[model samples]
Target: MKAWALLGAPKNQWPSNIKAKLLAAKKSKDLIIGVDRGALLLEELGLTADLAVGDFDSLQKDELERIESKVSDIRYSLPEKDLTDSELIMRCAFCDYQVSHLAILGATGGRLDHFMSNLLMVLKPEFNPFAEKIELIDQQNSIKFYNAGKHTIYQIPDYNYFGVVTLTAVQHLNIAGAKYSLADFNGDYPISFSSNEFLSEKKPLELSLKKGTVAVIQSKDIDRFQNI
Candidate 1:
């Protein structure tokens, strides 16, 4: 099964066609897990959350009550817990639901700390095994994780730019089928290879890494940057 974890980023940061996305997911019978105010967003969209998970500190009493009344399955966490709400939701998706793919939405354009936590969580040992199955998405960008291996990435429609960034010290890395190709690139620390485009949409971008984790981001040019 596939699952979608909706986070609590500001509504303005949500994708313009979020409703359509959710509707499609629903049609495919994907599990929808809402985190914190994300549950509220689903409710507002006239959608039902399969499960709700979060401390919900961002929601007012009435709002929390509303979600409690609507959603049947909820896992409440303490605000002082060791794991972030996003992490908890991911764990539930992979371990409990046994989802083969997990798409995360509303993870960006919030507090920088929160965004970083969501982006880097897949690097953790507990989550690393599923890195390739996870994706973080927003209005303008789609971020997917990769481990040490040769992988093929197909171009995403409407996204003109592609980027690769190391999450840790990386060994020999190679990128091909892109405007700016790389051969045997090595880095001791995190670095970004940005603004690279696919040479042809019909061709798949190839990536090979000997060690460490990397995130490949596909993005489109937007008229104005959303506030972070």
Candidate 2:
């Protein structure tokens, strides 16, 4: 799949391991974009961005100029808008560029509202076609959305735990190859199964659903000493 990576404005710095993964993706010809202050972060990390987007609200004039100097394509939005900067970039990537997959970094560490909005954006009706292709990555978690279908989830060696949560009403859901297995289960609002581990390192986790959308998360447990 042709992948695109977007850098969003987050409160904390990205960890080195995640940065390395993004660097590899960039090297493999993934279109990279920086959203507002994220452009500065990309510059600092020595990464090349195809474009820098969003209103220069969070940055000073000089900072925006620096980004402009580094990135050739710059897109500006009105200060007041219905869509967030990240959402605007998403629209551009999916609609304009028509990329098959997207990996979003620096999305989780900002304001609670913004983080939640970023996470829920994939659930939007307009984004349904790209739902399975979008992923939100942070230091501790990699979040992916899926529609009603059978899914095979591979174990991430870096992450110890996995979670599956229903974003909407789910019917005839089955899960296997996990420490706790579920079959033909139905979930209503706010239903989540957390802290599940893979049954085998080589075998993948299997999930099937007849209806509704869900988020699959591979995460490192902060409470655990080994990962922390």
Candidate 1 lDDT tens digits, 73-184: 8999898898889888878889988999999999888798999999999888998999999999888899999999999999998788999999999998999989999999
Weakest ten-residue segment in model 2 by summed lDDT:
7-16
- What is residue 146's positional error in candidate 2, in angstroms? 1.0
- Which 10-residue span in candidate 1 carries the lowest summed lDDT? 219-228
Candidate 1 lands at a TM-score of: 0.96
How do all models score by TM-score? 0.96, 0.90
The whole-model C-alpha lDDT of candidate 1 against the native structure comes to 0.90
The model with the greatest TM-score is 1
